[model samples]
Target: MAESSSTVGKRKCSQDRQVDEKPVPKKGRSLCSTGYGIAFTMHMCNFIVTAQCTVINITMVAMVNSTDHRFQFNDSTEGLSGDSSGGLNNARDTLPAGVPVYNWSPQIQGIIFSSLSYGFIPMLFLSGYLAGRVGTKRVVGVSLFATSLFTIFTPLVTELGLVFFIATRIAQSIVQGSVLGGQHALWEKWGPPHERSRLCSISLSGTILGTFAIILLDGMICQTLEWPFAFYILGGIGCVYCPLWFVLIYDDPISHPWISITEREYIISSLADQIHVSPCKQPLPIKAMLRSLPLWSVCVCGFTHQWLSITQIIYTPTYINSVFNINMRDNGFLSALPFLVAGVTGILGGQLADFLLTKNFRLVTVRKAATFLGNFPSSVLLVVLPYITPSYVTTMTFLILSCGLSSLCQSGIYINVLDIAPRHSSFLMGATRGFAFTAAILAPTVCGFLLNQDPELGWRNVFLLLFAINLSGLITYLIFGEAVIQDWAKERKLTRL
Candidate 1:
């Protein structure tokens, strides 16, 4: 996508000059902020939503093979600790007595894993447009509740057939696309300019924590009851969360019933002039956005980051199990541990970015530093992971460090969307995420193909590709990314029909 000038509205050059003439103000803080409450709700929403997406990763191992079909692996393949496809045999034995299995190849499994994003991508822009008009609170509530119900029924869909299961997954994700962009809209109304990173990152970190908690829970649930129970349990939790959301969430601080006077004043005052566009009415500057290299540059990182992230979220459990013969329960613990670190670092990176800005660091400087520090080490570590195969302590260390560091790029790339265009934050989020999420579709299929082509070197090839992508992404952002709002992104007075 490229930005070019279009005649949606004439720019108010004089008004823009007057606004810029006002003295820069000091940042404000309040003792009791309602924004934090909304942020936390979005955080929990992230957790449950992401958990649903990743639950299949753990359960797929059980779906594909049973102890009855021991040699799922080719004879030349050196996997399963030398026990005739050891991972599947143990996974089968670990499950409760009656679960059925399918004879799906790695390529077929890749399509299944990548299926959700296929639906999610197209719905992102449409849902975001709807949320801006119908209200995020309603859109998000319906979406969260529906996806939860779908998750609860995932196993039943599986019984229907492979195509049905994939369809169900896609349908579930289309609902989730609403929740993904809704929070960015919330931030435009509630977040103070100075607190943007901290607030947004706090909510976003829930995605990492959700992935961690679900993987851990999936193993235990699979061990105790069965694979289907993991979906039922998490889905049940999400259903319960839905009611709390409706009671608590509002579009903006002014409309929130529980917001204290002082906090409301603080938030409204702090964001008084920064957010100018009305997403409900403003016609996006499509040509201008198309021309904005900075926006697209940040988007590049979004793409590359998702490439690595989707790979980790979808395949980590299988990788650990297949390569090291880790049992289901232990595999869960190992796969989840890295994400826990990532969650912490995500918040820390946000705080760090905010601190640098508060202390007068150039916005581009902070962005470049975070982007480089975050991606470089992680890319190197991912590539190293394949080289140092099966080294238990070292492998775990690298994985954790890589995940933890890579999270900082969220602060760099994502928040920049709001930085340059708060007026279009939700729509931009949907657009950029739509672009980024294509990686989610590609990563699994590509990984599946690589693994299928050369079982022994497939994992190596995957990591090497991620490293190249990450490096190129960082270089792009360093060269073109900017923090200040672009002229094309300026608020324009739109004529309503």
Candidate 2:
């Protein structure tokens, strides 16, 4: 089965009669309305328009309430009341002896939460297979509704047992995965080729922005309210966002109603060959994928990069606090700055990649240089971080700069995905992530061990070991990470035989 349902090439107009084109390609004269066209574009656009408006409204509400911390994330009267009953307000009795003085529960929970986070990768891959069977729109709609229900009910569960906590996290993880998988398939069909990168950047940037918002605002909120309210606020945002997705999003470009003929033609011409549409052919099998050496190369390189990212996400806060002797409040604020920098840099990197493409740079060269090479420098900087120990500000600035540079590689990794398997980019992306997230799962655990080694050399060794791994991955890509799918496949078959 082909991933997409419609083709971009010239199709017969739907109407029996033809007329000259107008500025916006008047709806009356649309090919969709003509007898030859499928009306896919018209239907899709109308849905997306509705969904976008809905999301805008939800954002306003979420952000508005977020600004008021009292309703968001602090300790509640109930929590305080319970604290008095449990500990009777004693200093040492309130929290467990080993735990940090400040609210350490949520920090510990964040680590546990991250473990569930990688479940989305497998869930996404599984969802992609299902989407190929059912219509993408149907799967997305059902998944979104399921996600919303789970999100809404999360606040209702007051009991904080390990089972309940893990269950909620797992459910949310699966939903997040489905959302990405469905959205990826939808974009492969609806997004114009020329606009794919920009549109994708815009859409996924939400995660980055959301992280920033949570870090910046959550601090303020948690200061005044209960930790449970933090989860409630985040869940409510998801609930609001889910409904808007249904209204605004369409599965394919041809299904959209609002796009002009000229725009449709442009989209078709740009992406027609890339988005496959064969209902007769069998879907690519897992065995066939395993035999593809190029795919394996992608998996390895992607895992390498992702492991580094996961390490940073999990341990960077610990790094800042231990290395700089920073307070929790300042750590939250400073931690956000790196992500904010990364988000900005990532968008710029995408633009730079496109610009380089215009200059006739091979996609492989551009991706390799921009992303893989960028990682090398970051690794080098990280290795040197522990060695420098004069001022806190100087050390932190370097760490931030290192992470900011590493982010440039993110766009490059996905861009290479398109280079290798344009027709099955989403499936390949799922495959890459499925393999990569295993490393993500281990990154934190390994970091914990390394950091816990000897007090003096522990953190230093952690940075050194991680840097070496990063450098080795970069070298592997330099030597063997072929970007051209056909060439890579050919070379692999020869080696195997």
Give lDDT per model, in order.
0.78, 0.52
Model 1 clash tally?
A: 9
Model 2 score (lDDT) = 0.52
Tens digits of lDDT, candidate 2, 1-37: 4422232221211111110111211121223432112
Clashing pairs in 1: 2-290, 2-291, 3-287, 3-288, 3-289, 3-290, 3-291, 4-287, 4-288
Cα error of candidate 2 at position 5, Å: 20
